[model samples]
Target: MDATMENKMGLPPPYEPAAPNPAPPPSYFGDNPPPPPGFVAPPVAPRTTVITSATTRPGSTKLGPGPTGTTCATCNKSIVTRVEYVPNNRTHIVSAALCVLAGCCCGCIVPYCMRSCKTANHYCPQCKAFVGSHQPS
Candidate 1:
């Protein structure tokens, strides 16, 4: 009449303790076990390389005649400078004196028109900032 009596014949044999988990497998290291399979070591980060470079300071590098290449300080942009020539004061004075000595008033303007008698002013083409000047020696 009871449920236990009715199911006794269909039940599996009663449980028996499992052999104390078999002595764990031997490890290559003295006592530490190897990492479990499927464990990928954390990706080793690539070693960072330190690179040093020589830099030119704006003040240290003087601009030259023509379209000179340089970095602009105002805008901090690398560019080829646009050069504009203007008559040097010293050259003008000397030219005028030499012309008067030669007794020719029109000749005083000749040196002012010459490229070699002018000073070269360098400007950043991108920002139009004055970079430097090259005064003829």
Candidate 2:
């Protein structure tokens, strides 16, 4: 019936620290580790490159819808290229959209006839070789 005995019985147990967590696997650290034993790395391959000289002939040049002056690769002559208009994807898409909206009227056909909507194909007037094509920007 002692108050000390009752207080002792009501007291909680003393604290004890729990064991520390085990070290995490190396993969979790995200550090670059050494290669495994007896691992043979493959030999590096040499890089190949192609270069065009300006003195010989200029590289690919972007052309416009109008005549462009460029050195032809086929004839190796410096001359103004003649442009020929060809209906490209942009022309077709615009035409299709116009056709859908205008009920297949002359509006859809406008893109096919317009010079702005089509791609310009450049040809060397000397050799008549296809130089390059300019897509509408």
Candidate 3:
């Protein structure tokens, strides 16, 4: 191969250094700049709030009827009564069998009709921690 062919297959060309940045413009104001006339600053909302000894912070608590005297072990907050329907593993097999044997009506509708098919999962209202579950006997 020729010198030109060898150069083409060789390493890439050397990189060129970039030009130095131009000097920044001088500051018009020495330090603080005065606000324009009649330009009243927007009123800031007052931060005053009633301090409470309760460990539960505002916006941190869950929205629901909190169960009285029931303390959460996870977040140390009061537990609340919240019913969560979770799919039952045993019922899932039945549902799948019904789906295969019967049409969409029995398969899709039977599971929802059976309320006991799903396990009730109780969670903490504050931190959404899993408190306990109640399975249908």
TM-score of each: 0.54, 0.57, 0.39
Across 47-76, the per-residue lDDT of candidate 1 in tens digits comes to 999998546445546767677778887787
Off by over 4 Å in 1: 1-58
Reference-based lDDT, each prediction: 0.79, 0.83, 0.65
Clashing pairs in 2: none
- How would you encode candidate 2's per-residue C-alpha lDDT over 53-97 as one tens digit per residue? 655443377687889998898888898999999998899899889
For candidate 3, what is the TM-score?
A: 0.39
Best by TM-score: 2
Q: Which stretches of candidate 2 lie over 4 Å from their true place?
A: 1-59
After TM-score superposition, the amount by which residue 14's alpha carbon in candidate 1 deviates from its true location, in angstroms, is 99
lDDT of 3 by residue, 1-137 (tens): 66667679995555688769968887787687777898988899989888667555333433332332355667886555466776788678778888888866557657766757877666777887766666666
What is the overall TM-score of model 1 with all chains considered together?
A: 0.54
Error of 2 at 17 (Å): 39
